[model samples]
Target chain A: MNWNGIAAIWRFEMARFFRSIIQSIVSPVLSTSLYFVVFGAAIGSRIPEVEGVSYGAFIVPGLIMLTVLQQAIQNAGFGIYFPKFIGTIFEVLSAPLSAFEIVIGYVGAAAVKALLIGCIILGTSFFFVDITIQHPVWMIAFLLLTSISFALLGFILGIWARNFEQLNLVPLLVVTPLVFLGGSFYSITMLPPIWQTISMFNPVLYLVSGFRWSFFGMADVPVAASLAAILLFTALCLGVVWWMFRTGYRLKS
Target chain B: MSAIVQVNGLNKTYDGGFEALKNVSLDIREGEILALLGPNGAGKTTLISTICGITQPTSGAITVGGHDVIDDWRAARKLIGLVPQEINLEPFELVANTVRFSRGLFDRQRNDAFVDQVLKDLSLFEKKDNRIAELSGGMKRRVLIAKALAHEPRVLFLDEPTAGVDVELRRDMWALVERLRADGVTIILTTHYIEEAEAIADRVGVIRGGELLLVEDKARLMSRLGQKELRIELRDGVEALPDALAGFDLTLSDDKRSLLYTYKTGEERTGITRLLSAIQDAGLTLADLQTRESSLEDIFVGLVHTEEGEPS
Candidate 1:
């Protein structure tokens, strides 16, 4: 199993994360606070309660989802890409560890980093709004699944990308817009029928909906459908990652 | 000694249709140093990379300590350590942590004492806490060695270990290689410096045009293929060779003050006495006589030149 090898990679990555601990923790926290001020305080005052939950509390899960997705992608993407860029990836490739173990080490560390940021934003939310988790276990499960799935996607992105522009392309141009349009700051039910129908194709919408369901116990879509969406998304990403390693995609020539 | 590393009929062709290695086969003995000598694009690095499992071979089998490098890579890789030619490192990581990280990568149990010893052996103990970016080029090379040794592999591959280091560090590195050999570790180093091989390798392998031209015991190869030159200096300069010395194959110096006579070292009769007698009969007063042996570099150049069908 090469448990020690996996631990070594995990620890090495975590050390890099801790080296920039202040920036890692503060950026998302500050953004989450700003979103609350703009959307929760000022806008919520003019709007009525959203599906029996306060508007401020309504956006908490979406905010966590938004940040977790971004952090997971960026952390895992940069984590693997930097090694490739500096040529230190040769060490990892030549080691006794297998592809599965290597992926676990890198993706696990990145998932943990995103999970930490998600938790911090959750804590920061307590100060801004009154919140309750009707399904705490489900919330944790959703958070873990989303972090791991997106981290896997990020790992694939890292391997597939050849330059900095390509590395940042999907996360910035594709993911950020999807998150904003996928109802991170509002409910999809508030959109028109056609837009709501189109939102069904946005993968991030399911992540936010399932996560919000764990908090308020009221979701725009059925919880089972959202759960299926994330599970299917995770499986798809896993398949791509498996193919990348098996074929030695960008990792080996 | 029994072979600890065996490569059989290995071939590698890159996707771009570049044939980097051509049916290369080799056996590295345990506790002995083998030097691979070649010029650029001669497949030395590709061969090492394949055996270490960094580059996948197009075809052929390789085993380290009786374990297949492909199917049983976990076990085989655990027994090998590699120091690549490039100095790739985490600039922000501490020196000590980099070594420890490599040890763990090999799945070795955490042995702080051993890691510390490796650092001390490399003279990097004082800089253990410093980031890699803070070190000089020579010091970073030391860190690379430290990391490779941290795992304590039975077989080590040093690919151009002394390529860009200073003279003092190169000497120190050579000394360290000898110490490692004393501990019974098998070392294979590829280098452009023929002198490095002559000084340290038990056997020298010459590779040219993606093929291993020869691998033989250092002393035996030197004696078998090496040539010696005898130079006869005369008190007076002559513009042309004398008729009496015409029977011998000799070259006159451009200034015509000395004559050069070449002979094989392995020959039963060099005919030096006959040549000298003839030179004296030619009425040339001998001012000085000297003999010089060809170096490994000379032999290497001759071999490469012969392979290319050039005049040597």
Candidate 2:
């Protein structure tokens, strides 16, 4: 609640951000652009837009989602992860800082990193296609919501991770695939009705679909349902993180 | 004069049925540097972590500055600063920022001037802007100390702070600890280095195998339990001891160049002067004489090694 508490966390995180500024900026931008070239251009011409937009333009939100989610998750994950890795977590754990203080500090930092990546991808998407904003408010809403949600998820993952390799497992293998299956690039409508129904089960579908709706004024999922999923996921991740802090689960170990 | 930390009947058992601490109780007096000495797996770190509120005890209680460590952790933690054995810092952060961040954790006001003084005290002022990874081992250790000191906690715990460190840094660190004690900070140190405990600790607490052995003032414990030795160098080397001197409880060196005599303080004379006169009668001459008191290391080893009571 206090600015100084938040400032303490924000400063530490921002310093880490600047430490790898070149890498954090370059990796996501380059990766998302390549997604545009390969998935948008190479495959788009073969298939028409399922939702009345060019395949290139349709994929823009997904690419943006990719950068934002991964970077946000990693930003928060590494922020907490490296502390335990280098054993400096003892300093934070022993300090007068409470569990809530730690969450706010690290999560705020992650949101900033995810937001920066989202903005860069949105800015650079102009070169590949005619990216238009159908509703700026909703766009900002989904951007903030998705980034914060994933940042919380990453914060939990970082504390639970026992080693460096274990930290990579969730972000790379589990999360990236969930994004792919969540309708980031392809419409669940294009699939058979059975698979489309299953695609609805993926939580990420709502985030990407909702974000895409903000741009094109349409989506396979309803705006209301998307918003619900976003709120629910955010609440869930925050609850789990709070529990980790409260119980001192892997953080103590 | 009251206790800064009061631990009552503390016990800890791991998930696998391994008990690390059992019914341990002690009062850590304010403004005194108490050293906790033990071998590996003696539950030193476990006890310190529990007091810091990072690990929970399976049973019993601890209070720091009259606040229960579990029920009122924020206030209790605010009063205690713990330096773990590891040298972990944010590799990307500057030294000054690291210390400042620690202060802010306690919701303390920003005092750049005080932080600067702490950096200067630790000799980290010159590397204020340097990244943590850029500093050497000793500097990183100092950074941990500076971070712990930044919040100005009343109690500071150093867990094996100088383990694996060189002698020069170890001495310098002990000197700094003495200075902190002079400033009225209560210090609890755990070390495998016996000399550190003997050199700096006002009172020494030894724990072994999940049990508290004894806690006592340094000199009192030394005078009460420590044995003294009298060693005599022989002017003439002998292949074997004479039968006439066999009645004395004396040990001969392997080379037969010297004799060592040990006696309890409660015993008088130990017949040492009589033995010297008898040695001259036996035609053996004395070259030199020396005596030594038992050290803390000797007492600690003797205490822990004999607790099982099988001549181990």
Candidate 3:
């Protein structure tokens, strides 16, 4: 993709973000704070620290990740969705743009929004908990990887959803439960061995673990393995998107 | 003239077995504006969508500038631009930026000059910096056209370009369309506005029930299918027509102010003199007369209504 084209897309994407400041900034911050209040202050007070970190500090990454994940999915999905909703996708599709150009233009812009919101949540996080980055580079890398990954997943959702309500099903029903069950607030090591095995089955556990490992320098799963799992998931979603473009799936037919 | 677009045996059947276009084939000549006309659900939009590659054809093939629309959409789409009937644009972006970004989508190097020219041509330069939401409905409609023309496509498709536009804006857009045609853009417009087709189309094609009913030059189609109506105004108003005029095929006005005589198309002698003598013999006074040629609207109505009468 041309840098100029990418810049054009990025600029347009940023404009859309600022266009709805209420959704982009206010909603995420308010919702994450509530999660902090409920899951952190209320629930974490009773549970002991799983890995020498304060329960409030331990749950911070999970709350941020929840906002980041949902924001990323919604940004990417809605970036594509509203065009089809109002019938402007025709302009995009009919342009001389290749499938690669479209994916990068749309998915890359979505990742930028996700990353910005993640950073905002991080900055606000310091207000509530005395948080320090154990490995700033690892945290940034995991934040980008997970946001881009979920954004691509959301891009797929945008294409497949034909109606408004149908758009909410996957994120609200499936992804949220997976994020909650994933060891964001407490370590899987703190769970019973049976449920710990089940937690391992949740792909988001690997992402939350991988991201949490960045902040605290420890994770319920091996940090390297978790990193590898997140990378694999990202690659798989990218592959699905590439296949969709090649076959014109849900696009032409 | 070489064919700019060739559609052969195109068939599109939706999932529930509703065929939208059935084995439709045609060659659209280069540099001519072809108007596709039909009633609602007549496959006009489907045909244009298929040609533009917005909707996939279930069977058969399409080529633009000799490039297959499916196999080589890049080249094919580069040659075509479509302005859909709906006023769909990025609600937040400035008009200039939206048009500029559309050009960039084609990976065209920043051609701000071309973008500016399109804006000026569409009379959108004043609204260039305005967000799309700030524009009036007519301005928004013009923005859609400007976006479509940003790349200077060779074959432009306008699907109901003036569906809801006010008369003044519609005429302005029509004038702009004429200017584009003069610049050698081959336009294919689908419209329910039969008057628009009459006023602007070089050739017109009618489609109904998933089938192309006819395609002909504007003048030839009008002359060939065109009927003549002899509407005679009475110099003296009467309650009813004379019994001597019973042999003629006609309709009497309910108010008895006029008599309508239907005649063969383009007939040199309408048998008017004999009819007048008959009226005179019936002791009716002379009346002024007027004649009207069949409008494209009349022929179109005749075409679709006859199909309704056909046995299924």
Per-candidate RMSD, Å? 1.2, 2.6, 3.3
DockQ of each model against the real complex?
0.88, 0.56, 0.49
> Candidate 3, clashing residue pairs?
B235-B287
B169-245, model 2: which lDDT tens digit per residue? 88889989989999999999999888889999999999988888889998887776787788889998888877768
lDDT of 2 by residue, A1-253 (tens): 3356568878888877887878989888888889888887888778787667999998888888888889888889988998888877776786667787788889989998899889989988998988789998999999999999999999988998888887889989989999999988888888999999998898989999999999999788999999999999999998998888877888773
**lDDT comparison, 2 vs 3, better candidate:** 2
Ranking by lDDT: 1, 2, 3
- Model 3 lDDT on a 0 to 1 scale: 0.85
lDDT tens digits, residue span A54-155, model 1: 999999999999999999999999999999999999999999999999999999999999999999999999999999999999999999999999999999
Q: Looking at model 1 chain B, which ten-residue stretch has the lowest summed lDDT?
A: B303-312
- The TM-score obtained by model 2 is 0.92
* Residue ranges of candidate 2 with Cα displaced over 4 Å: A1-6, A37-55, B237-244, B266-285
Best-to-worst DockQ order: 1, 2, 3
Best by DockQ: 1
Q: Per-residue lDDT for B228-271 in model 3, tens only?
A: 88887777788776778888776888888888887767668768
